[model samples]
Target: MSSLKKDVCNPYFSHIYIEKDVLKHPVTKKILSLFPNAQSLVINHYKDIFCRKNQNFSLQKQTPGLILARKHDNLVYEGAPVCQNFGNQHFYYTSSVMNCIYDCEYCYLKGMYPSANIVIFVNLEEIFKEVKGILARHPVYLCVSYDTDLLALEQVLGYTKEWIRFTAEHRDLTIEIRTKSANKKVLDEVRPDKNVVFAWTLSPEKITVDFEKHTPAFEERLSCIQAAVKKGFQVRLCFDPLIYCRDWKEQYRNMFQRVFSCIRADEIKDVSLGVFRIPQDYLKRMRKQAPASAVLQFPYENDKGVYHYHKDLTEEMISFSYELVRKKLPMEKIFLWEKTKEEK
Candidate 1:
């Protein structure tokens, strides 16, 4: 069985939920064709299943259902305050999918949604239409894979390929598809376009093994990053949500050495740095789901509505990682997320 199949309790997507409105949509049909063995049910709306109360997020993750639905309104949204804008004035993000395949302990999705099932919005053309409208007014830097790892599900959904093709036609639209996926086959399948950036979020091997459950190992992710750079794809390396640990400095230093050794610093588009921070309400939900997670149980300081590591520690982590990266790449290529101060 495939690694992904092994990660889940049952075969991948044993049960599929289809919103009745999109049952006849071509995108839905294509997905259904790929999973003929999957038992699917048609429902009036995706929320009926996705937002239902009292769903056990952890239990359902082992055998998570797939939901095919149409996104009606608010196809594009201004970037969230917690997210790094990377100096883009017209930054925005759109979620073609609702949840992720990998269940990282530090993930905000656990608190953002009520269910663990993956939801794929089958209406890409509608989303593209909205993006074009924004591009007409000013250049748009959009994050297409914000809510889910689109590249990880590329074989099943093929949304990443579609986004690459769409980007080729629009000079003013630059889209970033961030993922922890180590699927190198995607590099061969999709042609590289300058307007499309493939951002990989990497962590230390220890963190990958302990906290980032079911994600690619540190070496696997690094290998994929090398593959992406060789294919001439615009690659961005994200060290964001930097997990705090007793030996984080040693781990991060070693990771930086391995990364720069495999690929030249000039080849990278840019690097981003951030310590773990999540909305307060999301952390509350996460604690309820995984009460024993060390990463979750940490006494994080509440900066406004966001919970994160203490200020001194957060600065120390980012500065240490930033200095290591600066040795290889110029300061212009580094983007770090910092906290804003408010009267206490």
Candidate 2:
């Protein structure tokens, strides 16, 4: 165990929660190796700890635990109305991992999950088989990392690499691994695939520092995207969930300038744009978690079951963003969020 002492547990989690059923999984073993310094406790199921009642979400978020278990049910789900389907025939997302390392004030995970601890499904082969079974009948468009920043955990999990290889073998499967991580080592470890789209969510430096706690800086994230473009990867930029802040226009304008300064606009596969929006229930839960956060206090109109900027501001924000990026990339390559026909 002396050599194990040298293993620094990702510096994010204080403990590793391992389900008794997955204790021997190779992926679980690999994850344990990375967090050798962390306390390991055995449990019958991940939800036993992950879904415990009265867990303090905010406090747990400061020192989240890592839970390794097998995903028994609901391996995949249809992409929600809040997400961009990218005109795919069959769009779906999987929560192979739950929760994230970063603590963004606007994150919806706090509302979706009962705990802030991260849960990783150790059974990769089962997920692959399930995906393959679906692909046998129809071409599938899957979002592999919607619920968590899988790429940020790539150093330990390596599931992103597995997905990359899986997609390379299955010609009919297309995947989007959306992330805000600046870790570029994973980029060099796997072969770039045309079927895989690497999407990075960008935020203004001020917003990032203020609302997005413990995430990579704007410059760092840009460097990683530049590296990906240079390596011939299908890199996509997601300005989705764009938060409104003081001097947002000037800040976003500078952000756009900084983004194009590193890579040619033509090199980007596509750009997605959307202003901040969340389900009404999720906003209610988030409000309870962080009462003082100005983001939660914003006068977001409750339209149907969703809470978002009022109609006029929503139009102005999206239109202003489109006009700004229009200078760098062709309008054809831009994807805008379409509101529900009746705002229902």
Candidate 3:
């Protein structure tokens, strides 16, 4: 077992009654220390904590920490499209957990939420119940993880594993776990379910090296995805927030070519493409955090409250990426996020 697994065996986790006891776990302890005065609510599971109306800013700033535990009331439904949800498939995304492990400069979590702490909702049963309710209605396309990368913390949480098992039983519900993690230990323990699609967000090596601090290298992510494909996992590729850089065309083309060389085209389920964009308010917060970043410095056009690359450039990048990915994946497998006319 991994060191992360061993940490769970600690005595502090025995009493899940009081919120304070939940924080007694060394992982939770380290996180709670950041917010000494913040109250803890120990519920039956992770999904119980409601987002306090005004708490978004404060929560987004802390180094990721645990939040309230409760089961999800509903699952298997579509979410409004924001900066992250792509493919325009009317995605139904459930947050088995909140916050992320990686700290990318462009991440909206930095601007949208006030805290940087990770909130792990331990209530899997509730989410499952909600999902069951949805599956009863229609064939649901679910995004298992949008707020956090369950795969990255798989050993510690076991939520993704549970989700995989759940999806395996429900063939009518299509699930996607989007992640940037290179961790494949979970793959060793669980077989890939046909209904569970393993989607990875890929970027050029340069972008990973510069902007995506602490994230796995591009090659490492590709290697992990290839390993999953070999195990019969339905794998999908996402080249989103395509950062603008000098020689971006050459960089992206090479990246695409390299990906195809490593993973067979037939193994890939589909590709989703989107240019970099963020809510305007989030951009301001990110800029405050890191003023020196070229990503933060770029003059973005604002559509409503969201900021993005100028209309023409955003379209060009999206179009170019769509064509490039189409070279390896079929058109039906390629989904491009079109910018709204107002966004132009």
Scored by TM-score, the top model is 1
1 against 2, candidate with superior lDDT: 1
Displacement of the residue 95 alpha carbon in candidate 2, Å? 1.0
Alpha-carbon error at 9 in model 1, in Å?
4.4
Report lDDT (CA) for all predictions. Answer: 0.91, 0.87, 0.72
Model 3 ranges off by over 4 Å: 1-63, 71-77, 83-90, 340-344
The residue-by-residue lDDT of candidate 1 on 117-143, one tens digit each, is 999999999999999999999999999
Better of 2 and 3 by lDDT: 2
Clashes of 1: 0
Q: Return whichever of 1 and 2 wins on TM-score.
A: 1
Runs off by more than 4 Å, candidate 1: 1-9, 340-344
What is the C-alpha RMSD, rounded to one decimal, of candidate 3? 6.9
**What's model 2's overall lDDT?**
0.87
